[model samples]
Target: MITKDIQVNCSIVERFNSLDSSGRLAHAYLFVGPAYIGKTETALSIAKMFCCEEKPTAGQLFCGQCSSCKKADSSCHPDINFINSDFGEQIKIEQIRELLAQVRLRPFMAKKKIFIIKNVENITLEGSNALLKTLEEPVGDSLLILTTSVPEKNLDTIRSRCQIVRFLSETKQDLAEHIRTHYKEDEITSQYFAYFAEGCFGKARLLQEKKWFEKKNEIIDGFLFKGWNDDSIKKVLEDKEQVKEVLDVLLSCIRDCMLIKHGIGQNSLINVDRKEDLKGFADRFSFDELVAINGEIIKTCKLLSENLNLKIPISVIKEML
Candidate 1:
């Protein structure tokens, strides 16, 4: 049901247009960036362009009204195959074999066959080996597009075979504008979410969709006023999937407190809505205590990354409090 009407960065669009117009488009492209940063959308846009029935005029890449564009937009194009980890966390070798067989054939409708592989980092060693052969010698007029949030996880050979296009996170101004126009939020609220997102529009959108501000405020109130305890830790750890987000919010609150203690302006703080609460916390904890706690939180994050038991880090966080 998803569509590809969302506009990507203008610079990326221009770059692709230049390559396509010059007839220098690479057979393989690796789109690397953080999650929800339009890596897949960009790849799909290119695929749509390749399959578009009508030629695009200057400054326009694809005609969205064309039949080819409609098919690509709806993800129903015969020549465009989307491979991902829908079956499991790791893309298995069986899927790779099937893909190989399909790519060997010619396009059914479009000028070229486009294969979009999402989360290439999750491809197993066997699958990567299988894909290596295809990448080494791509079939006639076929295009391969791979997208990954963690490019480092992909094999060096795979990285070498593809033309890497790095996608940077959105700027604060861009993110704030998107939020204001899409989410109908005020300037201050939009800016706060923009800063909190750390230039990732996808993260900002997810936070808005999840109604994260209310939950973040509750967590901050409990941590600062109610104090840390076993129950408090349990509440934070209730959803293991959201642990990182919760930790990020907690870290931002700590940063706001530190900024307030140092006489920094409220505008510089991400938790601007809770400036009064931050001021109180700033007065309650010494600068040294705040620094030590911040260090512990960072350590906890590292431990979590290392796959250590979640409880261990949560307990350590409690002790720091």
Candidate 2:
């Protein structure tokens, strides 16, 4: 019932299949991993397996032809509930209360009531407490699945009640092949996307669709190459929402320069397309300087996320550069 024909985590799939075969699936599960690695999709697939009208066999996870599978694929299944933050805000206690109320009821059409909470790390303290109550006294024929990129941010009590499933990031080769297959891009371009994505498929796809590399090039040309100055830093920091992404790109560029300084192969560099420029830039800074700059960029990113004054970090980075 997973509509997206993308590659899933085989280990998790095998685990789910084994659980299905033995009928020993847990009441609560936590899918923890980096962003864009398809934790939500895996959760949905499990939901489909639970709700499918035609019982899936060992090999076949879900019978896509069934009515339940169809509904699940379209996210219209009555029993499958998805809870997420509203408008980039935290999931409130009221939302958790409503979910708890609904979970107490029996399934309308499916065999079980499945609740999938996305960005579980964003659950407020009160909401976490409300969810914890349900976790402690699990309802019959009910499944709770929580997905989070930042599992460390989740409350310990909530995390302890669920069966944790760790999802590792995809390999660059696998991600590149996925891009080549789905986006119809050539191997070189796909590899480029894969390198910059840092093992995140969703980020690779977004970069491809949005032409983010072009934007990255503009930033690099104006800020890094043209020279690190007040105007260039100001231009990069203008869009607070994009500051993290800009910093990531800058980090990649600096990483590439370090690689060049250490005489590493260009094939392993994230900024493969700009090897010459990176090489030239590498000469200007010592290896220690590159490492220090990378650290500074990371610190700036952390500061920006804390809602600190944007100019403060930018100024620090300017001085570092």
* Residue 187's lDDT in candidate 2: 70
Q: What lDDT score goes with residue 274 in model 1?
A: 86
**lDDT string, candidate 1, 1-321, tens digits:** 123344365567667768877999888889898887777777787788778888777567777888888898788999999985532388989998988998889899988899999989999999999999889886887899998988888999999999999988878999889889978998878987898787877778888888887888877776667776777677667765567776787799888888888899977888898888788778878998999888888887887677676877767665665
**Clashes in candidate 2: how many?**
0
Steric clashes per prediction: 0, 0
Question: For each candidate, what TM-score against the reference?
Answer: 0.91, 0.86
lDDT of 2: 0.82
User: Which 10-residue span in candidate 2 carries the lowest summed lDDT?
Assistant: 1-10
Give one digit per residue, the lDDT tens place, for model 2 in 206-296. Answer: 7988897688888678657776677766766778767877787888899889889989997888778788988988898999999999998
* lDDT (CA) per prediction: 0.81, 0.82
Q: Candidate 1: which pairs clash?
A: none
* Cα lDDT, model 2, residue 193: 88
Choose the strongest candidate by TM-score.
Answer: 1
